[model samples]
Target chain A: MIQIEQISKSYNAHAALKQASFKVDRGELFGLIGPDGAGKTTLIRILMTLLLPDSGKAHIGQWDVVKDYRKIRQHVGYMPGNFSLYRDLTVEENLRFFASVFGTNIKTHYHLIKPIYEQIEPFKNRRAEKLSGGMKQKLALSCSLIHRPELLLLDEPTTGVDAVSRQEFWQMLGTMKEHGITVLVSTPYMEEADLCDRVALIQNGEILEVASPKNIVDHFSSHLYRIKGKERLGLINALRSLSLFTKVYPFGEYIHCTSDEAVEPVVISQQLGQLGMDEIVIEAALPGIEDRFIELMA
Target chain B: MDSIIIDQLTKKFGSFTAVDKVSLRIQKGEIFGLLGANGAGKTTLIKILTGLSGASSGKATVAGFDIHRHVEKVKMNIGYMSQKFSLYEDLTVRENIQLFGGIYGVSSDYIKTKTTLVLDQLGLQDSAKKLVKSLPLGWRQKLAFSVAIFHEPKIVFLDEPTSGVDPITRRQFWEMIYAAASQGITVLVTTHYMDEASYCDRIAIMNAGKMEALGSPGELKAAYQVDHIEDVFIHIVR
Candidate 1:
């Protein structure tokens, strides 16, 4: 469980966090969704008691983030945005070192890290720096779990990782939740928003919306459509020029267009046809997390 | 026009073969994407093509110059931008642009005109006198991209150009790439995001130093019987 109240932090002239407040329930997987300089890292660091917030109070369980910094440090596990593992040490040595820091041994927390550690066991003797990005992530997860902390804080864990590895990393987090560990993850990828129990969409040092991903999408007020045409850029330009469309964005293979009023698919198809576009396909679609984020941003 | 052609290109480091006899071709004005898991040899292949690393065997040609025989020519004809953006944080934005233009051996007059054009295009003219470290990450990334292609190189290699940016910024970044491709400049990009792969004209998926799959996003999806490129990637890499 985690709680924060009116937390605000500023570095010189720039305010990193402004009146930001959110809570995470026990065993809940909470996500902090934001861009690079949107204060996700600053908030995470404040909650971890590594940096002191200029104002407000935060508590992990009953311990205050400031007053109980020492206790909180032992009770929480943190994986920094940048890999902080000892590069010169072997995988097993790194794990052992983290375990020893918490006044425990690897065998003591073997059951806690078994699922993730087993994947990297064969390369236990390899130097941490030599491991692949995915492998290093797994090893970091393993080390973080070696202490059996009740709370886990992951800062953009899947930012530079591949899709399959990103999926696997999230899967590992899901398994951790099953083990009754509470997780707070920050990521720039909007697709990962759906995986969290709840997400706080932060931007420019302010929390815009905090809700479940489904709830966020449900709150999207516009009728959305997906339009595919032979000329991708031309389609975007055409759709943007239309008054019927409130927002037009190129999403993957199709251009996602939003309307203020409900519009028929046939009408859109006819309009594109009149515009000399070929192979036009228009269909009603449900909004996704990215769509909702863009709307919230606007 | 074939901007890049390769055949049986192999790059080995000591006992490990990083790139194992890979072959592919990229057309001019094409938005070619290289998709692969980390350590899948995508970086190795790009280095070999860009003349940063020597291939252990086989041959390749980039920008109408042999990679091995005419390394300088190949280097001169291509621009590279990685995730780090490779900008000098200590220098002002104008100074950074000038330094890159000088390195590419562009004339002083051309650098002056091009600098003004690039700053205007990116809307960073107001920040030209400020240090690169003072600007936001998004602005820095766009500036890095501008500097990379300032010389109007035949091919531009983008290595994860939109890694940490939000979805909105990523969309805007792709638009710039599209503009470059429209100008008949070949764009070869490597990305971990499958959603971005769909934006490319063609994509090649690499796995364990081998080309596991290569085709347009539509063709690859049809071949894999999947609706999304992520699923197609999983199907091939798994």
Candidate 2:
């Protein structure tokens, strides 16, 4: 439903997007995965026609982003990275206002936002500014869906939200996908990439890789290892000091270590033991999207 | 030594309790992690501890000063950095360091030395004169953290400091945290990232205004019979 071709945008000497190109298939849940200032927002804004790109072309369905900006606005719902709803307006009022802005009524599209809106419906009379962070996010999502656009563009919708809320937000998006609404969402969290049918990894305004999550992980050529023990920092430093491992970094309860050649867990255990680092747990591990992203970035 | 001590701390808004008699002690030079969902009262608790807001009941001490009886002393002894609250976007990096140093009452000479050290550590020597708004999010976060602890406060508070930052930068930020703790500065942090729980010396999980779990990551895992901290959190907060 969306096609972007060599789109680039720059401000002064810094390039926000350097010849970026990607596509979102019809009814596909595509993710733009990157950290802050990776041009995810710039790409989304260009597609929304809120900001004009310096070069290249983009289209939503049959209309060009520049030539038919008005037509595109009617078909895509955008929730910006920052909350953009009327702060003083009541939750219900915000939804109603957005519905009218698109020449539609809430009743006509109530089903589109019902799953998410109902979670905050009890506070429909509350002002947008008074709601908590999660509630405000749900309200903004409700407003965006109240218009029932064919496509949804979410910019870091789960960036600062907690895990539970982030999970629920993805579930809401899943429902949207089931209804044949195409989604193009951006997020800094690498774990969220698993939820998308396909994702484009971006960094410093450049696309690093594009593939399904499984495909991305499958391409991780090295055998990974999970190491955990006391003196977490010491363990990381010790592993880094060794020339045997290609990557050694802290990951949750354990350290994710990788090497260019196959290495046994017993070898790592013995090496650390000889260094006076005892009680270490070493095991073979599978690579996740985060591991793959870090490798690609490196 | 205990850097922070709390006894039956409680905060209320009208009839709703935002913090319910939460009590915990943190040792000096320790990385303590606070984990919670939204509306779980993590912010409320942090506010009470940071002296930005008061508790309706209970008692607490931060940085060896009573939070209620010595608000100014408490504020002076503690540092705070969050994704949304730190730094002046329009100001240049050097200007921000100077401004914060002045606010913290650090000696100008110390500020000068530390500023150079910080810029060197983050590889921002060339961009020190550039506006903070122009820096990438990772650099901004690193700079903000340095400014927070520049005064060498007894304790530092980081609220989701790595949120929205790249994975590599996030790990780099933790290295700084480890360095600070090694210097005998206590660190209290709140985050939504579950993996970060393992980085802490100890972690407390808050749910609905109450601390549902508190222990080291290994202990929590053993207690909950789970392999990952995220599983332990989900089990407690579900």
Q: Which numbered prediction scores highest in DockQ against the true structure?
A: 1
The digit string of per-residue lDDT tens for model 1 on A22-100 reads 8999999999998889999999999899999999999999999999999999999999999989999999999999999
The superposed Cα distance between candidate 2 and the true structure at residue A1, in angstroms, equals 1.6
In model 2, pairs of residues that clash are none
For model 2, the stretches where C-alpha displacement exceeds 4 angstroms are: B225-231
Q: Each prediction's DockQ? A: 0.66, 0.62
Candidate 1 C-alpha error for residue B38, in Å = 1.7
Writing each residue's lDDT as its tens digit, candidate 1 over B1-238 gives 8999999999889999899999898999999999998888999999999998999999899999999899999999999998775799999999999999999999999999999999999998899999999998888888888888999999999988887776677777877887788888999999878877888889999999999999989899999999889999998888
Model 2 TM-score is: 0.93
Candidate 2, residue B120: CA error in Å? Answer: 2.9
Instruction: Give the per-residue lDDT digits (tens) of candidate 2, residues A1-298.
Output: 9998899999899999998888889999999998888899999999999999999999999889999999889989999999889999999999999999989988997877888888999999999999988898999998888778899999999877777777778888888877899999999888888899999999988998889989999999888999988777788898888777998888776789999899988888888888899999999999998888889889
Instruction: List the lowest-lDDT window of 10 residues for candidate 1 chain A.
Output: A228-237
> Which whole-number lDDT from 0 to 100 does residue A291 have in model 1?
90
Candidate 1 residue spans exceeding 4 A from truth? none
